[model samples]
Target: MRNSRRNFLQQLAVSAAAMPFLTFEQQAYTPVPHNRQGRVLRVALMGLGGYATRVAEAMQSCKRAKITGLISGTPAKIKEWQAKYNIPEKNCYNYETFDQVKDNPDIDAVYVITPNGLHHDQVIRIARAGKHVICEKPMAINAREGQEMVDACREAGVKLLVGYRMHFEPNTLEVIRMRSAGEFGKIMFFQGLSGFKIGDPTQWRLDKTLAGGGAMMDIGIYSINGSRYMVGEDPIWVTAQETKTDEVKFKAGVDETIQFQLGFPGGAVASCLSTYNMNYLDRFFMTGEKGFVEMQPSTGYGPIKGRTHQGALAQPHVMHQTLQMDGMAEIILDDSQPVVPVDGLEGLKDLKIIDAIYAACATGQRQKLSL
Candidate 1:
């Protein structure tokens, strides 16, 4: 038994040492900028789905945030998550009863990770319950719904944040930093391709009533939101075209694929494609007058690899969700500003663009955007 334990420890040490590709020589010990002693943001996860599971697990590495409570419709899932996260029974609630969280002091905020259709109603109720809300992307089905959520939180005197995890990624931020510093001079064009051959026809994402739309609602919003932040300007106009190869599966109001274009105020144009019938399509490329950036596997879970005219982006990979939760913790608890805005207004802008895209597709004409 002693020998086996010693061998296991040695293997673990070897794996740890092999993780980082580059390492600095030990000299003066320097700590990263984090206040471990500060107040922790106790967040209640409102959904126990796959993404919520990922966020809850990643938050275990956060210094300033924790999963203090859980909200799920399934009692079995709540019980399972409670045992996994060491959550007290009082800190758990179902969708039908989460309004009681208003009296639960342990939960400072609730992250609504439910489906797109459920965000608007759930966020508004959480705000009225006197708790801050961190809603997942596409804040709502349309700009009108998104605005209502924003107004509800505002009237209730609470914060409403969007779950844009990419905003805090180290590599993505490094590219944005370069653009702000004039390294990528006068950006001219961007291309975002986000898609995957989806599975399961009975899933809610394939239902127009539940998902609000098709690929545009579920995956296309990435390019829509990514264009604004990458180009550093709100779009003035949008033109979109839709294609449906499997009408039987896609059904009415659910799109199979979409190709859209966004015209920025600075004359920068973005050409993007969102689909549910293709794979190996996750990529983003932006070119400026002086230099350019390219990223493949851009919006996936980890190791978003990319390069630019200068050289490869050198920022080491950190768990994107880990950085996102910690950054959100600072924003909620310490009022820290983010490099990229993740507020309800920011989310509303994306919804406005989405409305325009869908309109353009339906009318077969260019839609003018004011956001």
Candidate 2:
């Protein structure tokens, strides 16, 4: 029982996928429709970090969502966001007391953009407050925590989504649509390279306790999740090997680099690399009997360029977070499902795969995955 708006988006996606002959001008300028309708989702962001600032900036262009409130432990950051976003004093609260959001009529949801370790408790609390939740990727430290958040949201009767912005990217969706239509027959392989060099030794991401791990927790999950969607199947097994060039900086539990392999049930194989000691490593490639797709600078912020055997992908490039927020608004308000899911279950699957990857790294053996 899909909603009307969801059906519309699906048909629009099909239309776009079918028209491969469309000129660059026509495709590049095809912006997502504006939100002129009345019901904008009032959202309170629970983090005031660098990424949160980016989301706030991007929300200015969002049609169906708006920043209505702020939650942070630092009063300085809260005041700064309040003044900048025109948030009233009444709509701001510290981490110690955000549960009072239940009484606030303006906010319909809370977007949790905090660190890896804090997601489980924070999301449960926000759900208990009777608000839908949109959390950043790698939903929690592991699948167990992600499942708890999912169950809490289910019990509280609220929608739980993850910030998998790529799921809504026009070019990415075009590829997915093509795959679903069997343009690429009998999938054979996928390769994802996601990484960047580490600059700071003191950031929370370097702290195993706060981050739950290192490069894998922060950036590696991209390749793990990418392999699933590109192959259009969940992996059944994973074999991994870890490398740490700087023992002191990366710590014992934190990983500096990991190369992992995924085995899909459909006889597809994927090779992925995740690292914190490398640069120029963002790419995804997949091949089948009929066609192939390659994306360089694949998962970066903007203008995600790519080409398939069909030709270069000409889909419009909106800010990833902007499209994500607007699409999430539809999911919350209209109960519409997007072309690709960004729900809590999707996030949990990624976590389950991550858990297996880490286990493989530790045991130096193939770890089986059921997700």
Candidate 3:
């Protein structure tokens, strides 16, 4: 009798599960609220560096997005990109002619993938051209410039989004969701490590005027952002220690590596290390009362691996930048919010934390976060 009862209960459970699948059409056909059926977003590439090349490739996969404009100082690069992307001469602009892009009706947005120090001026120029702006990470050389960029976009009535690729990545999003849903219970501590052995001391990345502070500004920002997203909270205070193994390689104005700690409101702590002197070791680990989640290669360019207390996620993969561009398109054209957080406010918060970390490093004292 017990065996028969168990069999009946199993069948009942299966039926219950099948009911949702059988009625899936009822849910599947629900129309999207934004009604962006035929709209297409036309984008402009403002820089032609390695990152810009990657960004251009990513835009190819966006259903409602296309690269319609090209802006480069080099005629060779402009001609090459125009030919490769099939962009017309009418949509291409050099630094001298870029000011005229405001009159060009073909472009709706301009992506600034230039060095960190160049972000402020380029963003302002793009905003003045009446186009939305998408800027690479660390938004600017400092928080003040970041604020100015935000203000310029607001004044121009065009949207501004920071290129935070992880926010649109599936594995990172999964970790964020798990944390938000309380799957990890009361969060206690987190750890993040982001590093890459930077070569070519003469590269733009080592130039203080072009790349800003150093490893912290370029790749260390990832550690700052990852802890914030995974913890799902703004930090209340920060403490940091800066180190430089090769003074000649790092130079005077740039940092080689930095180890930092952030204190959250509920006593949660995050310890992070950012270095340009080490081999690649991008990872994030979050521990809480109930369980924990870990991601290896957490902040690389693409194809982030994710696992949780539930299990490994299975889906056909895409480039992280491609997914981010697609999601940005949806947000711009379809009025859809990003599944992962990637808004101006989120970018500003990360900058605020970064400012505190810098202050702590310089003062050799714990800095209290203002926001």
Candidate 4:
């Protein structure tokens, strides 16, 4: 929920002469109605995996959202979530019986937390079931699949939101707000490094058929998406480099580490890195003419810390997933758009960049982005 001071400040307009360099469009902040009273949005957790379990736990703290249904390939996991969340037997379903979810009025939406490659099909199925969808990031393995998911949801008249939780994170939003206020001057450059060492070599993420790619699809996307929003502009071109230390572990068609660069329309540039063989590299740094903002553990599931050239950010910490679920509830129930959008189109934009990055890496040449 947005505080009164911030709410009032968002409604205030700055003169074009006062902040000629700032993009006035990004400055308008939408305040969530903390006192909003309505029916709790019932969501079914699809894919009872690690992240899905985290979301389910966070939903318990959501004021306007509740986990009322479960869908999983593993019946044991489904039974666990059902008993833990007090979900009815009728709300439990496997992939074969998932189509029957269409008849369950208790469920208003399905949060697709499956692997990247599965999002396209499952999202379409959820839309066909007459339920809104909240798909995890990467939305799909490629832009084509992301667009299909978006089109299907639109055809079904149900909303499709991507689970880009960082967009709802407080500290990240503060940086965006500061950038929009001209505090960062004219944004000129961004640097993002996101990587983590993989533990299990045989995990589904290493399978190109399951993950679509390597680190880029799994965690590097944070750097890709962060560059766009932090710079407040779409990238016009991309150049990339891919390197693998162990061919056996990375396998063919999968990447271990990728370093990519994005050129924005204004000539502002972003240098990013994504890998699965490194640890504790999560960070984002943006610099404008006058000042800079820096964050360490930037995209982690945590108390993300950052400071601007002005001073320490001093922002309070909140669970990223908890804030995300509440913000999503408001988006679904009230038809309100968030300041940092997580809509399907936003997901598609990242996928387009990902596609370009991969092409650049493959061809050893700069790839143009239509987005």
- Give me the candidate number with maximum TM-score: 4
Lowest-sum lDDT 10-residue window in model 3: 22-31
Question: Model 1: per-residue lDDT, tens digit, 1-371?
Answer: 23433343344345445665321110011122476556888999998999998998899999888999999999999999999999999999998999999999999999999989999899999999999999998899999999999999999999999999988876776677667556789999999999999999999999887799998888888888777777777889999999999999999999999999999878899999999999888889999999999987678897989899988876777788898988888877777656577899989999999998889999999999986
Per-residue lDDT tens digits of candidate 4, residues 235-332?
98999999999999999989999999999987789999999999989999999998999999799987898888988766778778888888888888
Residue-by-residue lDDT tens digits, candidate 3, 19-44: 66422111111113332777777888
The global C-alpha lDDT for each of the candidates, from Candidate 1 onward, is: 0.85, 0.87, 0.79, 0.86
**Pairs of residues clashing in candidate 1:** none
For candidate 3, give the lDDT: 0.79
How do all the candidates rank in terms of TM-score, highest first? 4, 2, 1, 3
- Tell me the spans in candidate 3 whose CA falls farther than 4 Å from its real position: 1-35, 313-315
Regions of model 2 farther than 4 Å from truth: 1-37
Candidate 2 C-alpha lDDT tens digits along 210-243: 8989999999998987887777788899999999
